[model samples]
Target: MKRIAILGSSGGNLYNLGGKEPLKLLGEIETQASSAGIKIAAIQFIGAKASMDNANESTLSRLYTWNSSEENIVFSEEKALKEVNGEAKKVDSIIAKMIEDGKVQGLVLMSSDPEGVNNLSIKAAAKKDIPIVGTGGTSMATIQSMGGKVIATSGTTGTTNRTRAVAAIQSLSRHWGLKYKPVISSSGKSSQNLDENIFQRISFRGIMMAAIPGFIAMSIVLALSKIPGLAKLNDAFDLLIKGLPVVVAAIAANQVSGLDEVGIVAGVVAGMLSIDGGLIGGLIGGILAGILAFYLIQLALRWNFPGTTANIVAGGLSGLISGLIVFFLISPIALSLGNGIRYIIELALNYNSIVAGAIAGLLIWPAIIGGVYHAAILPIVLLEMEKTGASFLGAIDMTGLVMVSAGITLANIIYPKQKSESAIAVPGFLINIAFGTFVEASYPFMFSDRLIFIGAILSAALSGVFVGIFNVKGTAYVPSVTAPALSNNALGFTISMIIALVSSFLITLFANKISRNKRNKEA
Candidate 1:
């Protein structure tokens, strides 16, 4: 079992601007690793306080051996100051220990911090030949840009990150055997200190760049897939649309491995699966193909068959074997899984849709927040949409979200202090709540105050009930509230939206009072 390492956060304000904290980031990474059956060996991080104390200490930083419990991790500036007078080498020391330990196969530097403890990782890679794979940290970014051959990916979503961890495992495992892969990095705000560099931010813009291809694919596919006039080209567009996830995932895996050749071969395998099973299957197949390709290459490398021609022969043969594996084994499984999930969706719809709506409404927040929703759940909804020309889950998901959000925003406007503090709330409440189904706009209120979130659950769930009761259905599969408006029973959807809004408003009034009372008492 190859164990992966989780390095802690970036030191300063860049940390604040970046998405999740290092602790949370590590936990997510661990989850991703676990889901794939990969074992994580260690998680270590230097706390922000250590840098503030103008000293680093072994005691102040935290490390977990095999388990990540609260008891195992510790961070304190005072602890550093108390234990060490000046800068301490605990991070470096731990890196050294990880290298010395035979079981700790690789490191995933999770820090967004550009400086501090990661310097040790870089030095260890350069001199002692340590195997480190970074996902989001600035340290890895910096080295990769400087012409260092580091194996890393800037994975923003959980599914993508899971693929990234697979890449890390493969690269690290290969590295331990030969230590030949060069130290690579990407430039981003994932550093220990607050440093504003234009290039770093620009390099992290790959996600934005990747989105262009997806949007183009979606636009062409959407225009081509649904229209009977374009039926002649429907298969071609469906191929492009469904195959996009495999292509995207393959590209990301290649970037992380720096093995474009293998990624290309794996992508072919994944694309074939997409033709059979659609997006979800393609994604799963893409991952398997990518990992298996690398695994094949690693096996080839171990053979060391004595010539420059060996790589070509080995890689070609490996690609053939990998393709066969994907075709014979993965494709059948993927098709079966797709059928099973569709049946599960049917069962969910059959099990009292109001309850389903309530469940979907409640679960959507966490799923979106955690990002697993996009990878797994949303695709299920999308598949249902494609098949039925509508999705009960999608309606349950979006209508409730929009109306309940509108209610919450209206409630916020009624509050003097809350409205005054956030100036933007004064002008754009209606347009944002009604129009924007990104749905995260409502999150600020929830994160700022959970009472609001609790209130929101009630309204959203009620909205779900109304949507189910009305048997609201959509013809055009769209993203949010507009989806229902463009549906077969537009009035039913609209009425349900209004019902949710009213319910949210009335319930939130009481919830707001309870919240304020709790806050006042706490104060």
Candidate 2:
């Protein structure tokens, strides 16, 4: 176990900044580290009282209460006071004492004012070559300035506590997994946090890529063995048999890792049934659920439903309906359809090489990666790939889809009001429809200003055209937006996507500037 010195804020100058924040940060860090198998030999709370006392009385009282209650932290006032003065030698002496006793391994300086007491501690620690971990007291900009690792989590004030908890857990898991469990210290726990919607797009992309392929394979083997020559094709048979299990296992792992039960179910179903009913079922179900929730809430509101209550009810209902539709209606239909979608994909694969290639791309890259990211579109890609065998056409489709989605998402955020029901909404519906249909949910933001968004989409469409013309194909999906890393004709996909991204950015910016100027002139 490494020893950690938790230096609290000093008095007067910068006490107000991290007086209480240090406590919170320390508590979180310690708890997380401990959970990850780290051992804390000792904790020194330097100048916690003086630092907090110098702040508002209320803040001081809170610190006093917290320190007195925690059994792990040993309150030390002398080192803190000495560090505040130019007598840092005295502080170092204490640290030396702890080190000589083999009780101290590293230092955790929690000061909002890094220039004050923190600077002294940092200097001393640097001289000793001791590792330091910063928390709320340090700025994101300055935490790394001292060459120490600083972990940060984001959330609103209301959600900070919850965010902190999750952050603590994640940090702990990472530390434990990496075999760095040594010593940990922490501040008290709090619960304020933000919603998880911030990561939806990233989540969406991962799930679709893996689960979809598994679903397709499952559907074929389980329900549709009747197709002519299916058994005779060794590669196809191998993929249908072997690929299905691997995809499913990966999806299960993904579900457990993210701790998302809903995502797990949706992902599994999506991957298991992309053809006869799964792919269309998910899309149709999602759309219908959205529409039904929208209408039902509207109707309920007319009868005087409370706004908050109505929103919760509608959202849950929508999600529920979507899930039910996918599981019940889609899965069975997909199973019974006897490789119908695969048959179509096979026909394309046999006849048009490009189409076959594109289908192949959808199966390998997008489906698996999407499952990892989104998990919902897993079935479609998996089904397509097993049938197509990594065709060029598939690569084109995957790249085109991702680019458009990215553009639309970017655009929507930038021009949120412009596309809203009220005035000032910037074309969200139009952009969303365009990209969402072809790509995932990441494309709309390309032109946030207007010109850039339009330009990007146009470039993307052009890229798609190029794909069609060149017959560039791959056996795997476009794993990421980067073209160089693409499976086949990687350079081509990379070039096309980049062009789309840049063009969209320019067009959207120009359009937005012109629109703003015209409005200014009118006024």
Query: What TM-score does model 1 achieve against the real structure?
Result: 0.49
- Give the range where candidate 2 is weakest over 10 consecutive residues by summed lDDT: 153-162
Give per-residue lDDT, candidate 1, residue 325.
54
TM-score of each: 0.49, 0.31
Question: Per-residue lDDT for 1-523 in model 2, tens only?
Answer: 4445555443333344333454554565456455444545434333444544353432322221123244454432333343334333344455546655556555544343345434554455555655544334333235457654443322112122212333333433443353432122224422211122212323334434545545434433432333465554545555555345324432432232231222333333333333234333444343334344434444443344433334344445544655566566665664444268656645665576454443343343334334442343334445454434343434444445555444444544464325451222234333433332334343334324445444544555565555544555442232343223323455665665555445544455455557667877998
**How much is the lDDT of residue 249 in candidate 1?**
43
Clashes of each: 22, 109
Encode model 1's per-residue lDDT on 196-281: one tens digit a residue. Answer: 22213222124223423453344345445455786766667555555554554455334333334545555555555445555444
- As a TM-score, model 2 comes out at 0.31
